[model samples]
Target: MSIQLYGLCETHSSEECNFYCRVCMFALCKECKKQHDIFEHEIIRAYKVNEVASFRLADLESLRDASDICPYKGNGRLVEVIYKRGDGIACCHGQGNVVECESCQYRLKSPSAKYCSIQCKVEAVMKMNESESVTNEAKRKVETISEESASDVKSFTKRPRE
Candidate 1:
């Protein structure tokens, strides 16, 4: 069978020499072999061309599978998980700096806990205060109502039969 090989340099003794290094598994040409001092006496061995090709094909297939099973493709699941655990949010650009907002749930793009705008920050703080106040007031009202109801029940039960 006839095979056309592109990019293969025509040189003598090409068949005798391995296509790649057995130690590093890097593809090498005939000139590279002499330059690197690779010989039968050399400690390092050379891998066959077919073996190197098979290894590369396997690596490509594994990479494709890994990309398919990756969880943080579009959802940024890894970042979200880290942020939810209070470890701070990582920059979208893969920087080590983690962005977080102390006053609100909004994540910043920098180390500073800044919102998109000053107004948004202020509104967030105000909303937080308002909600806290409402909760406290409700608790106070419930306690007062309970006390009044208890007093009324006591007085009604203590009334003599007249």
Candidate 2:
């Protein structure tokens, strides 16, 4: 059973098919699978069931009312199937705390994220470095003036008062 023939997605030519849409009877990549999910269409792992008999059995199983539950401890929420990052499923419940990006103030999806995206993170770091450079330049100027004033004071103190 070689799925190499159906490896690439028809719609997304550049992406490889990871899921099979039973209703449409075609293979789908991770991005194209989202539409089928919204329509509540039956979807299965492309590698799991490529044969005609397996598709029929999967459809029969989908007709049941059984639902997938979260595997995390103490969280009994229903699981949402995620195809984008492999076959991993996630629970709907979040930690209740929201993280905002430091530069743009945009809401962050990842819990440990300091910025919303790579662009924002890069911009924030650049600005911080720029300010530090300006501050360093100003400190150098002040130190130079202080050293010149000290030299002048030493010359005045050494001269006898005529």
Candidate 3:
């Protein structure tokens, strides 16, 4: 009496059907059956079904309690960009005399004027003339009062009472 093995294929033979090995779970042809049986017969061991079920249940519980939020989220802080050495102008947030151009909005290092272009420098100076005039007038008024007060004090100190 011979038992027929179902789904055994050998290279395009319609009489042979493909089947997976019970041990290694690899598809085997009729010619490869002997090679799979040699390895499978040695490693046939019974496993506890209850232990496998408990392990899978623990994995599912841990996955359910796991956090979805990222730990590194919003951790980066804003940093100020520093200018190169000998650039004469400090950074935009630093104590530098350099500024952006009002007309073109270009950032440039300037010691005397806030603008990089000659036209912008000239315009800035002209626009600032009114404030300069007011400052000069205030300084002159203070100097006049100081001088008059000094002379009055000197004259009073020099006079002798009758």
Comparing 1 and 3 on lDDT, the stronger one: 1
TM-scores of the candidates in the order shown: 0.31, 0.37, 0.30
Question: Which scores higher on TM-score, 1 or 2?
Answer: 2
lDDT of each: 0.40, 0.50, 0.39
Task: Encode model 3's per-residue lDDT on 28-135: one tens digit a residue.
Answer: 454555556665332211111322100112222333211211111111421111111123333365545555555344464443323433334334556789889999
Question: Cα deviation of 27 in candidate 1 (Å)?
Answer: 71
lDDT of 1 by residue, 1-162 (tens): 011112253464343433344344344456655665645422222222322211222222323221211112122212111111122333344545645444333445545434432223345567888999999999999999999999999999999987
By TM-score, how accurate is candidate 3?
0.30
Q: Give lDDT tens digits, candidate 2, residues 48-109.
A: 32221122223334543112211111123222221111122223337468655565555545
Considering lDDT, which of the candidate structures 2 and 3 is the better prediction for this target? 2
Give me the runs in candidate 2 sitting further than 4 Å from their true place: 1-96, 159-162
Prediction RMSDs, each to the true structure: 24.3, 18.1, 35.0
